[model samples]
Target: MKTQDIFVLGLTTFALFLGAGNLIFPPAMGLDAGTSLTSAMAGFLITAVGLPAFTIIVLGRIGNTNNLTKALPKWLGTTFWVLLFTAIGPAFGMPRAVTVAYEMGIQPFFTNDHLVAFSIIFSAVTLFLAFKPGNLVTYIGKIMTPALIILLCGLGLAAFLSPLGTPAAPSGDYQVGAVTSGLIQGYMTMDAIAAVGFGWVIIHAIKAKGVTTQQGIASTSIKVALIYAALMASCYIVMGYVGATSTSIAEHGVNGSVILTRYVAGEFGHYGQWLLAAIILMACLTTTVGLTNACAEYYQDTFKASFGFTATVIVVLTGVIANFGLNDILKVSLPAILVLCPVAIALVLASLAASTFTVSRLTHSAVLITATLFGTIDAINILGKMPKDLGDFFSDTLPLYNAHAGWLLPSLFMLITTAMIGRTASAEKKFGRVDYRLKTANND
Candidate 1:
């Protein structure tokens, strides 16, 4: 792809990932972290920006989401794909975007009574834009994303020029293990899951730009991921700084939207409020459009449904779910997000390793299975569904259990063990009653 085309694709990728949690979580974390902002932000950037970029790079080599679990059985792959797409689509992600936009952008200016009308209008616009999935790069990357960036940059500049106050001392979880706290908080963004879902759109976009070869696709994807990471990291740092310094103006423990609103209003007054409103609306709208398009396409291809019908259904579902309010949506979604994120991380890492090493299907399955088992236990504990004694036992026995990531070590161990076993089996079969040099030369 040409340099300009790559740049545009990068903007689209950035916009697609910059949705509800991306806008909210960092500021709230920064507020809590305060003096510990550097360590907390470091952990936040790892999962929020780094994981998603790494996911894109892996998918670029492996092909789209359908290829993600190809090593598994057909039924298992389909089930995993369905769950992943649903989690990042109409079920949680898309609705969360609508609610965030409504709460932050429209609710502050208007009354709560306007939620129904706002949802309808918001979904309608998303539906219209999503109807032409082919034009997403042009519509979002070329147009909406630039405007959103400009507004965000303005807010960032104001935050930098004027000081709010010295950051307060770190509190609660941030008082200790701030990095782990931030890393867990980053899971709320759900961008890694979105990256898997958005892989098809991006690959198609690159192909549309005449990059059809696997090497070309992977190369372009790296460039896009770098650009996306740079933009996301900058925004997170600026927003975290704004939140950290706003203790004098805004109270702690409030949602990030409120903290940001207070900071912007204090800095720029009424006009600044409007600027924030514009920024939230644009960010959420682009994400909703990209998600709707990606999900609708998935359904159309997988289930043989009509694209228009699927799009309409997804939009309507998102609008209805948005009425549940942001806090409620987040509360309900957290358990599921917690369960899926570790598994997604494991899958990304396994895929990367498979691309480099001679890995077997059993290795991939074992790693993911370990991740899923532990991840489910973590979710159960979080939801208070597990027995207190059992939960405490696991927490005490498992490393990083307090961080909501008890699955990592076990998954890594499973990968290494299963990979070694597979390699041994292959070696034995190849060396059985045969000269290694003769076989190697014949194969070559």
Candidate 2:
């Protein structure tokens, strides 16, 4: 990739990653984390940037998403990816975008009447983008990102001119779990899901600026990711700092977007309000477009729907769903995230755990079995009714589980154990070494 290719790809990747969720989640987590912002930021970066970049770079290296997805056992890998992105888009994400757009973008105009009208307006704008899906990265680069930057700059400057007093330390035991909360909040951002799809988008961005060959594209994407991630990390650091310090917005237990707008306004007056409105609108629009386009592409591949029709249907459906309201979206979304996040983390991070291990199919199978079983139980325990004794037993007596994630520890143990055994078996059969089962799948 040439110099311009790297620059454009980096900007495109940044556009892909930034969103209203990104802005909203980090601040709230920071607000609660207080003095723990450093640790929380570390955890957030691991999941938000590290894991996401891992997903995209790995996919770029592989060069074929279908093969990458298909390489996993029983088709679980792709299904997990699909379900995650779908949830991030239609189920929770789009609606959040709608309401956020209403609060931050449209509220300034109507002040009273805007909420109802803005919901419809936000959905309509999203619908237009979804209907006219194009090369997503390029489209954002050409239009959406410039608008986003102007707005962000205005807000940042406004915040600089007038400041909210540093916030107080977190209340109660929640302070102890700030790192864990940041990790969980990272899941809500859906960066891992974006990681799966944006690799191709990154490649396209690179190639458009003139990159060719899988190796070249992969190398360039990594460079771009590194640069983009650093900038994003800086943004998180600043926002986290702001949230940690700011005391102007009284804790109403309101939504993050509401908190953000009120905080800005209290600090910088009406100018901050106007600037934030533009930022939210632009970010939401870019996110909505990128997500809808990705959904269209995946579905077209799966069901033979023409790209145009598939994209249109996704936009309209999600837009209509936005009428449901932001707070309502948050309720169901949190439950779903608790279900999907661990599995997504497992799948993406397994490649990193033993990067040299090449047992493609067996590794995928083992991780899927371990994670899915555990994730389901974890979700059920958290979100659904289960017998008291049964829950306690699983939480306490299970090999490597807890009330929170009875699946996580056990699942990890299971995958590593299975992979080692499979490796031994493979090695023994091939080299007449030992008859250890690890030889079977370990080499992979």
Candidate 3:
């Protein structure tokens, strides 16, 4: 595609990936990172922007959505995709999107009844926009995304010009390993998992633009990745800086959202609240539309269900779940996100390198299984208590457990070991066949 085409595609991709957490997390990181803003944002960008961009490239190579499932064993693939869709769609993602819109956009001005009413209206609009898959890029990229960016730019500029204060002392997790904490926090965004869901949306959009063939897809994906990385990294840096300098509000605010709301109100006076609300709603709505469409497409393809049926199911289920509100949804969904993120990251990285390495089915299975097990333990540790001794043992023995990257080493070792074994087996089989052919020729 041309420059304009790639630019629009980038806009669409950016809209799809930026959910409530993307909006909320960075500033909080900045608040904690304080003086370490540069290192922390750099680290955050790796997992948050870099990993997701890489996942998009991997999906482009595979060409279409179902091919992601081909990376693992058949049943496992199906199960993973199903669970993934749930995690990023109705169960946690969609409802969270709805709540973010309501909380940030509407809550201060309205009552609980009004929030519920707005959610229904929000779900209806999402379902309406979701029905026409081809229009997703046009709706989000051409229309909603521009408005969102303009709003963010205004807010970012205002914050940048008026200094909040010098960044306070590094606090909590940022005090020790700010970069590592930022890395893990970036991982927690779970955008890689969302990318898996959003990949097909991107491919379809590219196809709609008349770009076919693996080479074209790969090229376009590269362009999209560059745009996504640049755009997201810039936003994160600004937001993190804003958070770092928010020492005055830091006493009153515990999270990025709180800090942002206060800053906007302070900066723009009465109008800031309305501007912030609009920005939050736009951010949440775009993500909702993208996710609903992606999940609907997946279900239609896999279960042989109609698109209308699937989309309706997703929207309705999501609407009902949203009533549980944001905190509860996060509580239930955080564990799943923690466990699946490592698995998703591992899958994308392994698949991208599969052509260069002697990657076996065993390698896929072993690495995923190992990562899942460790990730589950990590997830459980988040919600409730693990045995003190066991937790201590793992935290001390594992290389990066304290960094929330305990799964990395185990997954890497399994991938290498299984690949080597598979390569050796293939070599031995080839030699045996050659020897048998020689023996047959001698007898002749």
Best by TM-score: 3
Better of 2 and 3 by TM-score: 3
TM-score of each: 0.94, 0.83, 0.95
lDDT for model 1: 0.85
What C-alpha root-mean-square deviation, in Å, does candidate 1 show against the real structure? Answer: 2.9
Q: Write the per-residue lDDT of candidate 1 for residues 311-357, one digit (tens) a residue.
A: 99989998998887757876877677777877887887787777777
Top lDDT model: 1
State residue 101's C-alpha deviation in candidate 1, in Å. 1.1
User: Candidate 3 regions off by >4 Å?
Assistant: 440-444
- Compared with the true structure, what per-residue lDDT tens digits does model 3 show for residues 1-444? 778878988998888887777888988888888888888888899988888898998888766767655767789998988889999899999998998888888988865467678889999999999999888888988899899889889988987899677798788877778788788888878788888889878888888889889888878888897887788888788788878878877752388899889888878989999998998888899999999988988888788999998999999999999997768877877788879888887777667656466666676777789889988877766656678888899888978776677888888888788888878888898999999999999999
Off by over 4 Å in 1: 324-333, 433-444
- Model 2 / residue 339 / CA error / Å: 2.3
- lDDT by residue (214-324, candidate 2, tens digit) is 778668767887877876786677667667656567462446666677777776677768777777778777777777767776777666789787766666667667776
C-alpha RMSD values across all candidates: 2.9, 5.2, 1.8
